[model samples]
Target: MSLAEHVSQRAEKKESSMTQQTQDTTTADLAAGFAAGLDPREVAEAVLSRIAEREPVLNAFYLHDPDQVRADAAASAARWAAGTQRSKYDGVPVTVKENIPRAGHPVPSGTALANPPIAQSNAPVTDRLLEAGMVILGSTTMPDWGMLSSGVSSLHGISRNAWNPALTTGGSSAGAGAAAAAGYGPLHVGTDIGGSIRLPGTWAGLATLKPSAGLVPLHAPYLGRAAGPLSRTVAGAADLMSVIARPDARDYSTRPYPQMDWTKILSSPRGLRVGLQLHAGPGAAVDPEVAAAVQSAAEMFSAAGATVVSVAPFLTQEVLTGIDAFWRTRSWADYKALDEEARGSLLPYIARWCTGGKDYDGAATIQNYQRFGQLQQATREATEGFDLVLSPVAPMAAFGAEDPMPSNDPDTPMTHISFTLPYNMSGQPAATINCGFTSDGRTIGLQVAGRVGADDDVLAACAWYESVRGDAAPDWSRVP
Candidate 1:
């Protein structure tokens, strides 16, 4: 089937689930009611109503069970009513990436071939969220195996950006970013191997954190790594991260990290070392408006006592080339193992790229790993004195819904790694916060990256930045 045909089929499959009604409660309002003893079922119903209203156009979700969500919400509400709400996320509606498993949900791994039977258990991350009293709204969509930056999937239709429906929502966390931005859910859990979470967050004007590697457990099978939570505010992101940052026995990659008192740490952003990179390597070019927005944010940091300075040794082509090789090789191996018919049904762009493994050889793969090690050494050497690095989250503001990124031009060779890919390669905690809007009215994000295992530091920097510049609330009036 063609990509469009597959999308049509997926849309038809969801039509039934999308028919449910939604409620008119904002996160703040829901929290207020919970504090005042309102029934949790009512809150869940409100969230459902909003999802029904928004899902058709945004296509943010892949699976939803209003009945199940309502039941979970009711249970949570009862706990709160009995003065037993266990965690900070009590009764909040949140969505997880489809790649992550929830009990009884199929683990598609965002691919048609891997549509295995329903998962028998929850991923460790999901368990943590449930422990924190969060109610699962549903699973959001991603590209097949999350190999693409644009959130276009053969199994699921394109996820449109909330800002401009015509523009692409940066992916593979496209649906999570759009859903959270549109308020389908105030919180969304997504993973970032490349720029999945950060790119979408930039496109949707939402706050996203790609925590340092190993800070959060990687319990999802097939993929050895993933992260979660695309939220409307830095605080919301921090809240979700805190709950999921614990060590999980099932995932050996998870390790114990410093216990975070996020609320206390994020109360202020004073005394931070904020280094700003104006240019991202040789030949890196950014839209004038985006550049201005980033500069404006640097100035805000300076006003807030952050030492913002122009710096170099940002990201070298050698580092990004190595990371690209790693992604391609891993993806090619996974794709080749798919059933013949299932492979045939994949989107052409994905099939073509994944199957084209001419550039990767055994020696090349080993060298790539070694190159990454050298890149990490370089990063550590240059970033030792700074607490955080600030840059434009993307080279440009959100693009047309049909096109999430720029054309694959050689001059803009580093566009894909503009501000996000480096952190993933370095395994450092990085986040994006809404700084301001362009004259054309699209949102611009300020990227903040901290030392490895400094997830709390990244959040604190975002909190401080937000406090100084004020919230970048969605201008509903500008919605197309």
Candidate 2:
């Protein structure tokens, strides 16, 4: 039988469990409630209360305006009452990563830069969410400059994992994942250049998509940064994607595609080709449990009639060289732009990274771009036959909350993010779906990536995995 058929049978056997625990304001659950005459104000209040009760532990929000949120919720409630709801997201609460601009909000991007100017306009992603009527709950946290994969942000302190406060919540979309895991609300916007979205999503037991670069237009100064959703359910991510991926003239990088119903893409997984990629490169070492979880995900896909094959590492030296030379160095140039006083205010490690970017001269920058082109082409050739690629989101599990990166890595601080950065270099679509948990209860994410402009296919593959892999949802009762 097909995967959809199996899901139907499973659904029949397992009666829908909308327990009180499951009522933690997921996108789908909130939408259904709003459609059924639920009061948007009440939903907003519950979310605010949860944030207030949990903020001390999670540190999920950098800034949240409760009064503004209530006003928006009141407007949304009025719209639903008049039978004029904007969309399925009309009353659903959502969080935006701190780096992404929202009108009248502070865009700290997790830094101690003194009294930064407030945003006077909405980012395209934020505009789209507001247009679709998603109630903005607040802004989530991220590492300073979004450079690290761990949750140590000097500006916001450290964001603790919802699963375990002692462990780090992987970043730079740190608070988005923590908020989702902590049951703050359903839909959240997260930016991923490297593994920001996927790493945090997995570590916090949430579903996330690093949509194709140019899939969701972003305001980042460099390439490879894309804004996408983090949610507890694949359906929620799909719904948010449909809204935010809409074309915007402001974002020159956005690749325009005809509006498609992304939700319908998950119907079947038969006759699909899936490649299982374990190691990112020679030096990258994956945790045994993470590899096992990904392996199990591959087996589930194969059982669902998809052709699953183990693939060799395709991230070549050229690709690695390009990403390191162009992306990271160029990113540090922004910090390099800051005055010495502002730079001194930055976290010491962030200042170190910025200082390192000074070594790349003009000739090297141009050469890196050329190498970037070659790497993109090579990545295209590498996975030509596969509809999707399956891999581990991070090489290791969540480490200490205060640590910048993993503890054992002596040579490079970026090893944990190795698996997820190649897609950024190639500008392809990738996602992290929670596959299982570690013995210590850290969530494990299995990545699904597809060719550039094949975001729907990637989302479909994730939806398929979630369907077949029963128990994809986190236990909200355990949330902080």
lDDT of each: 0.73, 0.78
**Which numbered prediction scores highest in lDDT against the true structure?**
2
The clash count for each model shown is 15, 0
Model 1, 185-264: lDDT tens digits are 56789998767898888777878998888878876522224595788777778777778888888887666777866664
Measured over all alpha carbons after superposition, the RMSD of each candidate to the real structure, in angstroms, is 7.7, 5.2
Per-model TM values vs. the true structure: 0.88, 0.91
- In candidate 2, what are the lDDT values of residues 1-480, reduced to their tens digit? 222223233324322222222335456656666776766776677677777777899898898889989999999999999999999679778899988898887887888888876998889888888888888988899988788777777788899898888988889999998888777777889998778899888788778899887778776535667889998888778888988887778888777765656866665667989888888783458989889988988888888788988888766655565556665576677876888888788777766655666678888888877865675676677778899889998877788898877743322456576678778868888888889878777888988989878787788778877877876445667765
N/CA/C clash count, model 2: 0
Candidate 1 has what TM-score? 0.88
Give stretches of model 2 more than 4 Å off.
Answer: 1-25, 265-268, 407-411, 471-473
RMSD of 2: 5.2
